[model samples]
Target: MADWGAIGAVKSAVNIPVIANGDIIDAPSASRALELSGADGVMIGRGAQGQPWVLAQIAAELAGQVYRGPQGHALADVILKHYEDVIRFYGPDLGVRNARKHLTWYLERLEGGMELRNLIIRERDASVVLKRLTEGLKNCGPIIEVAA
Candidate 1:
């Protein structure tokens, strides 16, 4: 958790908006941060990694808006699309290497992810990695799609 007292102090001293960040992982935490720190808003870091839709979810909660995150087949589609984008942006060789970390993060919270994590990080071939991802997603169960 962030030092709310310090944030409050800073907010008082500054004319610009004060956005609190640190160890805020969900909408409730964000709301608490705003209340405690008297901040204009909150910023998320590690919490948003691999789970891109988290920010939107948090924002919606704060704004009292309705938002539905992708799940099941929709999640698989998003992950596949992200994989393809990474490959296209970096090209096969480097992209595969770079995407390993992202793939691991994406699978971390999934039910049967350890095996998939091993396969994804171990394989150097993009096609093989993608195939493994497809199979892994089948076994991983429901997933929340992270926006790009």
Candidate 2:
């Protein structure tokens, strides 16, 4: 939504590539948005927040290609690293707070995530959050939670 205007306007004004950013969550949406905005390419932002493979998905579909999602353990590691990055970016207090939401999301992708999410929210700081998240991983046994 945020980049629609710029994308549309740029597409209209120049022959260069006009990449639309924001709110492109899937292949249909990506194609529809480009069609609507008359843009050359789409640049997704938050839509790929937790699902990094979304970019490849869109790219593949739009480019008449196929894209497979990340592997299980590989995806888990990506998610865990994402939490660590968030903690590093936002610091322990805000980071831990932010990680809470992300952890919930990560948990949902697994089997029994609600309990783990509930347990994680109780953590007060980054270290505790990380610990709880790790514990959740170990104790909950393969729960992929996605925060709402």
Candidate 3:
């Protein structure tokens, strides 16, 4: 559990803005942190690892808006774009290696995704990994369905 009390104490004492961070995964948690800590905002860390859209979701929920999140082809495009950008930033070899963990997180919740995840982490070729990721996302289920 997060030390929300500690955050509250800090918020009361500190002159600068306090941002509560730690285990603030979803809207409810974010709301709770803010309510208890008296902070300006909450900071999401690992929760946003693969599903970066979670930020939007949390925000929408806080504002009483509906956030369905990306699905199907759109979600696939987002994942692929992220992978490609990682590859570009780090170069083929380093990029592929660094992206393995992120890809794993992205597919962790997929139904029957273990095999694809295994292949993705072990495979060295960026093209092969991208192709496999695309196919797996398409054939399995909705992006949100597979989210861990």
Candidate 4:
């Protein structure tokens, strides 16, 4: 954050909210980021991936409130949505090609994800990729488990 001192200073001097980006990927970091930037708020990017609740958590914490997302399927659903969005945004060939990155990103959060990530990277067919992803989701076990 200190590395962005000049940008922060300019924004502060101008009385405009100078949102700092990069590096900060979690709530704790977001708080420290606010202190470091001396700005009005923090901007979350990759940190919010697979965790849409991150924004809410940061906002809640900043407001002096306790924040926690519902445990089961919360992370998985978001990752799935991200994958769908990628496919939707990019189309099959390009989407699947582009999906490699997001797929890797999604799988990285899963246990034993590296192996799956490697497989995804090697795959060339879009349908195969989606199939493997569905299978991976099933075999990888519940991202969120509800205790009976």
Please report, in order, the local distance difference test score of every candidate based on alpha carbons. Answer: 0.82, 0.73, 0.85, 0.68
Query: What is candidate 2's CA lDDT for residue 88?
Result: 92
TM-score of 4: 0.76
Across residues 1-148, which tens digit of lDDT does each residue of candidate 1 receive? 4686689999999899899988887789899888989999889988877778889999898899967677778877778889989999999999998888778777875666667788678788899888888878888855534433
In model 4, what is the error at residue 81, expressed in angstroms? 2.5
| Consecutive 10-residue window with the lowest summed lDDT within model 3 | 139-148
Question: What is the alpha-carbon lDDT of model 4 when measured against the actual structure?
Answer: 0.68
Q: Residue by residue across 23-84, what tens digits does model 4's lDDT show?
A: 66666777777776677777878776555676898888778898886344655566667777
Residue 59 of model 4 has an lDDT of 84
State the lDDT of candidate 2 residue by residue for 76-99, as single tens digits: 677778889998999877888877
| Candidate 2 segments whose C-alpha is farther than 4 A from its true place | 1-10, 14-17, 138-148
Which should have the higher lDDT, number 1 or number 3?
Answer: 3
Ranking by TM-score: 3, 1, 4, 2
State each model's C-alpha RMSD to the native.
3.7, 3.6, 1.8, 5.0
Clash tally, candidates in order? 0, 14, 1, 0
lDDT of 3 by residue, 10-47 (tens): 98887999999898989999999999899999999899
Q: Which runs of model 3 end up more than 4 angstroms from their true locations?
A: 144-148
